[model samples]
Each structure stands twice: as C-alpha cells, then as structure tokens.
Target: MAPRNGYTGEGGSSVISTDLSHGSVESGESLQSTSSPHRCHHVMRPARKVAFVYAATGRRFLGCPLSGPDRCSLFMWIDEAWGPVLSRSLIQLWDQAFLDSGRAARLQTKKKEMEQAYLELWTERSNMEIENQQVVNKLKTTILDTEIKMSRRLEFHTKMCVAFISSAVTLASVLAYVLSAH
Candidate 1:
C-alpha cells in the first residue's frame, strides 16, 4: 500500500529520512510506497512563501501570496520550487526597468549639455558681430578725416599759384617802359 502523509505502513508506522537519501527514488510507485516520512514530506506539503532577492545587495523581499489555483498547479514531488522561479522572473524584470531608467537619465543629461553649448555659441556670435560693427565705424571716421585734410591742402596751393603769376606780369611791364625811355 502507498504511504499517506507522514504515515508509511498500514498499521501506522512513523518513518524518518532526509531529503538527500529520498532523492534517489526514481519510480513513482517506489516513491509512493516508501516507508519513510522524509520521502513523502516533500510530496505532501504545499509551498507557503516565496522570496525575491536583489543580486547586488542580497536583500530578500517577500512576493505576493499564491492563489488556490496556483498552489494546485504545482507538482506534489517538488518542494518550494515555484518560489525560485517567480523570484528569478521578478528580478529579471526589475533589472530591465533599472537599465532603461539609466539610459533615459543619460540621454537627458546629454540634451542639457547640448543646449548649454548652443547658448554659449550664440552668445559668442553676437559679441563678434558687435566688434565687427565697431571696426567698420572706425574705418569710416578715418576716411572722412583724410578727405577733409586733402581738400584744405588743394585750396592753399591754388592761392599761391595765382599770386606768383600776378607779380611776374607787373615786373615785365615796368622793365619794358624803362628801356623805351633810355
């Protein structure tokens, strides 16, 4: 007869065995008929709590309670097997979420840096335009001053030439009169 719960024999006998020794039983009939309480202990009990752990910190967190359907879905031969599966799944999802958040933060930082660079470039361009305009103004002022000086020199030379021509004409007329009188 197959054992029920912790009982093994028909007359009600208590059998005790560790998990390592019971794991060698391959046949289902042999596993059920085993006269050891330890062999059936893993098959009789449902898993109660599942725990998830952070790989970096090794801190464990309790997961959600399993429903009746979920408990019934597990095989009786495995002990607390669903806990590790669920914990690993949750940890993988959390890791992906963290990685995505980090990438978004890096992109935001890059955007801020680009904006600052553009502002600095714009400011420099404005300053350069102002300096260029000042240089143009200075050149215009110098050209105007040079043109005024050239005009004044030309007027003085014209006056000197007229005075010399008049003096030469009067001297020549006076010499001709003296020669005729002698």
Candidate 2:
C-alpha cells in the first residue's frame, strides 16, 4: 500500500497487504507487507535539511540529516523529530572548555598574588637589616665615649697624688733647718 504524503512503503511491516498493487492501497494508512522490498521502501525516506550548531566548538553543521538510528542516539529532539545529539555534544564540549579556561585564570591570579606577597616580604627583610646596622653603630659610639671619660678621670687622680707628696717633703726640710739654727 502507498503511504500517505507520497511515502513509498519503506518502513516496517505494512498494516495493509503488500501483494496488492501500489495504486490499490489507500492513502494515509499503514501497510501489512512482510516482503523485504516493501519494508526497505517504507524505511527509506527523503533526507531532510538540518542545521546543527556545536556548542563546544561554536561551529555549525548544515544540511546534515539524521537517519533512524541516529535519531535514537540523542537524548532530546531538536525539532520536527530531529535529534539534538550533535548539538548536545557540542554544548558539553564548550562547557568543558570554558571551565578549563576559568581554572587557568584562577591559577594565574593566585600565582601573581603569591609573587606580590613574596616581594613585600623581601622588602621588609631588607628594611630590618638596615635598622639593625644603625643600632650597632650607635652602640659602638656609646662604648667609645665611655672609654674616653674613664681615661680622663685616671689622669686627674695621678696629678693629685704627686702634689700631696711634694708638700710633705717641703714641711720636713723646714723643721730640720730651724732646729739646727737654734
């Protein structure tokens, strides 16, 4: 039997008898033909024009029509019984690519942050070293000043002792001369 919409009986077993001539079959009705020729004819349909966009690659595939097996592979229908398999695959790939890019960016940012922190730490360490050197210089100066003051005090003490000895000698000589003259 001739299928509706000018479909030659190419699909599965026809609901109507296949022995009957093509013109005898009524339109808009299934056939019951078990013959391989009729079944092949029923299965074969004109390829429809389809356009698909791959989400992952941002690429478009045009004029690619899906067969019966290809239609079953897709999870969702695109439109007019077309499968969204290619589109869905493209979308998944695109999502993965975006995620990878995001991860890479985050890592790069983190690395920069770490480098900045390291530089700051180095600067602080250098400043501390300068301050330490200054402190050492001040300590050395204080020590030198204390040594000079101690040396001056020792010299003054030595001069006082010499003057006292000279005075004692002069007193003794005067007593002896006066006694002898008397």
Candidate 3:
C-alpha cells in the first residue's frame, strides 16, 4: 500500500499514497515491480501465493504482501493452465482424499471402541478369578473343620473302650477267688 504522501515512480505514474506497511521507508531496500499500476513499498512487495481449492491446488497467484483491511485490492494468477485432463485428475484426487479422511476417522473410532470392550472383558475376568479363589478357600476351611471334629470323637471313643476292658478283667479275678474259698 502507498504511504500517506504516496510514492511517485518513473514515467509520471503516481500511486495514491496512504497505505504504507509498518516499515520505515528509508531502509533503502528495493522492491520487485508488479504487472499492476499500484506501486509497491520495500516491505509490501507483491507476494506469490498458491491456491489449494480442489482442482486449483498448486496454482500460483501474486497479491499484496501485507494482509489487512486497508491493503490494496491487487491479485493476479501466475501459474500456467493445467488443462482439462490434469484439472480433472486434481479434482478427483481431492475428492478421494476427503472420502478417505472420513473413513479413517470412523476406523479410528471403531478401534477405540474395541479397545474399551477388551479392557472391560479383562476386568470382568479378573473379578471372576478372585471370586473363584474365595470359593475354593471357603471349601478348604470347611473340610479342615470337619476333619478336626471327627478326630476328637475318635479319641473319646478309644478312651472309653480301654476303661471297659480294665473293669471286666478285675471282675473275673474276684469271681475266681470266691469259688476257691467255698
């Protein structure tokens, strides 16, 4: 954009001056000339840009280097034509990329869902293992209790049998002595 005082160029072409970019004009840096009538400041040289819209991707254009509301309204294409076949190919490739990106997004979501399901199944398996172990421990404890009770009963029965045998032997000896005396 031109400065408030404007820049007068050779051949009597004077550009309307209020649009200088935020750089000092005395830096002595030269700017490249443009095909338009607008004069460029040192810092506001015409910038080459590429279009990325569908078939126009890779097409180059020249516009004001400074970007803002008050910038000049100059833009021109600098790229050669892509012809009908290449243009169609570029459009088809762009469409394919769009479709593939959407598919990739869906696949990513599905992968996350599968991972979540696997984690839940793993947690459930761990819980079931814990419960099974608890049941086994309870069964072991009950078996030990039953064995201790049976062992105590067997010991009591053994003592009673020994006492009965001792009393019968003593009674037989006493009966023999009485018969001898008579």
Candidate 4:
C-alpha cells in the first residue's frame, strides 16, 4: 500500500514511508532495502531524520517518528547489519562518534567560560596595581612635606640661639664698666 502522511501502523506508531520507485534520494541513488534486527523495514524520509543515541554510540537511526510517550520502540541503525563482528564494530563506531561530538560541545562551552573568568581576574589585578601605585606616590609626598617643615623649624631655633648669646655678652660688658668707674 502507498504510505501516506501521518499514517499509523497497527502497533500505534506513526509511520512515514519513502517511495522506492523514485530510485534516488534527492540527488543520490535510492537506498536499497535490507533486513534489520530491530525494525520492520528501514524507513528513509529526509525530512523525518532522527538522531538516536541509545544504540551504544551516538548515531542517527531509523525509528518511529512519533515523539515522547507516543514514540514506538523502533531502533534500526543506518548502516547495514551484516556479519556479527562487522555489525558490532559499526555500532561501536557510531556510539563513539556520538559521544565524541557531545564531549566536544561541552568542552567548547567550558573553554568559553574559562576565558571570561580569566579576563575578569586580569581586570581586577590591573585595578589593584593602579591603587598601589597611587598609595606609594601619596606616601612620598607626605614624607617630603614633613622634612621641609622640620628644616624650617631647625633654622628658626638656630637664629634664636645666636641672638640670645649676643645680648648676654653685651649686658655683662656694661656691668663691668660701671663697677670699674665707681
């Protein structure tokens, strides 16, 4: 029977069938029919592609289109299920690919976060350095001001000492001259 849009099978799963007569998928050759261990038939609807990550590696598989609770348990790998060893290897490869892609995405997100944090820390450090330099400059200015005040006070004290000594010598000379005259 010709598969129609929104068609449901007896198992209650939505089915989207592909026309095999076209013999080509868009531009490439049509996908030949093959038996799978899990699905009734391999359904290829480009518009209805799904990424199935449960099949060991993260690979896209042909499964029921219905999502959530309505989705059917149809898990069929895209690659051919040939000999036992070959099929197992293929599944492993697909699973690894999926895992690697997921990890890569997470690592990229982490790298961005780290870069932002580093930039913030650098900015904080620069601000602190500027503040420290300002404090140093202020300290130097204060010391210089204190030294200038102390120097001025010392000069004033020295001049006062000289004037007092001169006045005492002149007074003693006058007393001695008066006593000698008497």
Q: Give per-residue CA lDDT, model 2, range 76-149, as digits (tens).
A: 11133224785576557546756787899999999999999999999999999999999999999999998888
Between 1 and 3, whose TM-score is larger?
A: 3
Flag regions of model 1 displaced more than 4 Å.
1-82, 166-182
> What TM-scores do the predictions have?
0.46, 0.48, 0.61, 0.46
Give residue 166's lDDT in candidate 3 (0 to 100): 81
Residue 51 of model 1: what lDDT?
20
Off by over 4 Å in 4: 1-92, 173-182
What is the number of backbone collisions in each predicted candidate, taken in the order shown? 0, 15, 5, 2
Name the lDDT value of residue 32 in candidate 2.
30
The 0-to-1 C-alpha lDDT of every candidate, in the order given, reads 0.46, 0.45, 0.59, 0.51
In model 1, pairs of residues that clash are: none
* Model 3 TM-score, all chains together: 0.61
Q: Give the runs in model 2 whose Cα sits over 4 Å from its true position.
A: 1-83, 166-182
Tell me how far the alpha carbon of residue 164 in candidate 2 is from the true structure, in angstroms, after superposition: 3.4
Q: What is the lDDT of residue 77 in candidate 1?
A: 32
35-121 in candidate 4: lDDT tens per residue?
433443224322223232222222224555444354445554453324666457655755676678789999999999999999999
**Model 1 lDDT-worst window of ten:** 56-65
